[model samples]
Target: MSIHPYIEQAIELLKAMISIPSFSRQEGDVAAMFEDFLKSTGINYYQRKGNNIWIRSKNFSDQLPVVLLNSHIDTVRPSSNWSKDPFSPYEEDGKIFGLGSNDAGASVVALLTVFRLLEEMQQPFNLIYSATAEEEISGDEGVASILEEIGPIDLGIVGEPTQMQMAVAEKGLMVIDGIVKGVSGHAARKEGVNAIYKALPIIEWFKNYRFPLVSDLLGPVKMTVTGIEAGTQHNVIPDECRFMVDVRVNEHYQNKELFHLISQNVNCELKARSFRLNSSFIPTDHPLVKRGETLGLRKFGSPTTSDQARMPFTTIKIGPGDSARSHTADEFICVQEIIEGVNTYYNLLKDLYIYPV
Candidate 1:
């Protein structure tokens, strides 16, 4: 089958974006490129004090609810094992292969295509296109700036790769640190209480810790120890040891409940065991899901966490490409999937705002 003209336009745009390596905080160049695209299309937009760029639709009116289309411009660092040049976009078979092909770049292109189509049709809706930065580590710096300035909106669509599925819910993320303290002593004496040894109980507790199997669109909560550091050297008993824990939580469990549960299970002899919890976001069964389904898009929940967990709007993770290909050596997105995503998003906007009953 021949490709649609809009899809072709999107393909060219995606290639242009993939050529620029917008890795995390280094999104200045790509953001500028997006700004140029907006200006060329004659869309009204402005850059925030930070690197984020916001594009507003000319159809903004009092009757329509403002819709925000959000996607990050940054991609994770490219691995050395990539068979093709990471920054150089390439098309093989039916897929577009590049560094950010699957993670989020596909969604970025889809948004661009959808907006262009909307502008062409003179669609009636208050739309905002946001290209954010620093989403890999935390979205606080980038997204917070937008929220602080623009305030809240009616709804938000986060363009993360959901394999053409509408992700109505996602698990929250919490980063915790465990510190164990013990007495230091020489290896020859071997009389001091080893902090490393004290950490054993904590490890055991973590191993046996039974996370509640709560059923939701996203599934059960999970906990994992991401990093551990204890001993100083072979000849000394280190007095301090620290480990990091990553937890993906469901809506049923709040941070306070989980923290109290963990503290209760931990023994008191490990000195200080503290945790730092971040804010959580939950997705609602908004009208957007029905709109997406009407456009022939699949509906599902996200297994992994995204920046949507930090936003307070009725957030949904939906976009082109597959999550399995994300953060992999040969990351790629089918060209057709990108095209379908653009049409789907266009239809969603039409149903929700342009042609709403």
Candidate 2:
């Protein structure tokens, strides 16, 4: 009932996590830190081979299904222009400033704090606190392993920074790579087929490509050419040109259909050269979303992807901190928002476990 002690604990945990720089696959140290914290709390937990940690409550019961609270432990590479050291935790104007503070460490810290509180209160439902890795480049290894080992679950809350709003749905992502081939020759000779020139048509097509607008709980789908590279020298005609495209799809389009459209419509050599594609994930609304909405949480759609894509479960994305602040220099999250996030998660657990009627 006393929130002050819990808030203080949350702040301490956030400081501890920020003190360590766990970038993507390099999360062993922070994972160890979390494991030690869970052990100190006397909770049952273990570390997988990939260094991902999972902690469970001992007071688990069958009345309420098992709930998995998930967040990534890794952060993107630190920016070079931080006012303070990226790894050093600092407080300014009621906000915590650090590299991963707004990106996801805030949520991880809050979740761990909530887990400890739940352990102390002896919560009824089987609770799992999962700090996963490799979320930035798709969570193929970390979340996949957890799903394969732990099997299916009743519900999952993806602790992504949504500024404390409830995200019931997110757009599915498709990553496309286009390779164009051409003849390599001296630039002085006009006889060479320039690959960069070949790629220009496709790039132009993309510029004018009209993406279909599909209305769903989350609004319209979008396509963005995120990366492009071609030519090794200024005077030589490039033999190969490669570019990457990110397509955000809605429920109206299937991955297969979208890939087909890209392959067929884009003016390029489809056989010898190539196009590679990767699909996104969609999580349907579950009982947990409904219950959280009743608790005064605002619902919205997410344009980005998360670790939820790598698993098959009734997943919802919720947490504190602004998405705009994420991955930016001087990234930060308000101390007050972190406290509110803890209370929101704590209440969510109580609703699902204690009052499931």
Candidate 3:
């Protein structure tokens, strides 16, 4: 059992990254540091777009299929409830604590370490390692901006805090803004349609209606009415009602199709924010999934979205740390977790063979 020799350096790199505040859409400083680290490792030909940084294997061959190893480099702005400075990295027991340490810094540095090792050797498929920005806010400047340069990818491994388990299916996010129209009138007159009253049934429909297609791995499509604005005052029957829906779609349907179904059922005028991040699922028979099964990793569908949402390819999400610890006041990832992440990632890719996608 050969262990990753540079695990120590990987941990140090994560610590260094945590010390810098790489908040979403504001990762210029940390991106520069990441590039510096790559240069130090003799990897100087990395492609940079926006704040995302990506590099391919030195012996990258166009003939082979490409496997993209991706993780985000951005953290959310620290909430007002922290016991320690969020930007400061510290260690306690076997855990490293700081912002972004668990959510993705651990995975980013682990993948970079594995990339260094893989570049020194050779794999069945070409490798592209990327540390992307703006995952926290799901901004356009992140992984989405780099795909054109990295070219086609057959498969992607999104590194997130999944406790080393495999997320074969991930829920996609779609926000819908809705408006219900009615005629305004004085409350005493009782002669006008109340928009707020009109919206109740539509909101109830979102809560009760179920999509026909249900994914076995991801289960049902979930939608919630997260926000609403209706009445102008107590005396007047408001003519317009606006609401926001947070939809968690399964891979069984596209966002646009789901929107059409909902709009047909509800009386409100509906508009989907964007259909780009529709739900994603990799087949259980996919070689990547089958490969992880050999290592006895448990498979489950993730309700949360990650950088995987941006990759329109066959992808799996797996990494160290616990998803529960991400964005907490005292965020931490075990040092041992990073060590195992490197080993597991290396084992998964060391001999991976790509078939037609």
- Candidate 2 ranges with C-alpha deviation above 4 Å: 1-4, 61-64, 118-125, 182-201, 211-213, 226-241, 254-257, 267-285, 353-357
Candidate 2 lDDT, tens digit per residue, 265-352? 8866432121212223224345566667778887777777887666565677889898888898888889988888898888777636
lDDT of 3 by residue, 1-357 (tens): 444557877887888999998999899999999888878877899989889999988899988999899999999988888898878888999889999999999999888888888888877789999999999988899999989889999999999999999999999999999999999999999679998999998999999998888888888999999999988889999999999999999989888888888888987699988988878889999887888899988899999999888888899999999999998998999998998898888888887887853
In order, candidate lDDTs are 0.74, 0.75, 0.89
Those runs of model 1 whose alpha carbons end farther than 4 Å from true positions after fitting are 1-5, 119-125, 186-190, 211-213, 233-238, 268-284, 293-297, 353-357
TM-score, one value per model: 0.86, 0.82, 0.97
Candidate ranking under TM-score, highest first, comes to: 3, 1, 2
Total backbone collisions for each predicted model: 0, 0, 0
lDDT of 1 by residue, 22-120 (tens): 888888888878777766656545655467877666666667667778888888998889988988889989988888888888898788677666755
Q: Cα RMSDs of all predictions?
A: 3.5, 4.0, 1.7
RMSD of 3: 1.7
Q: Which candidate leads the pack in lDDT? A: 3
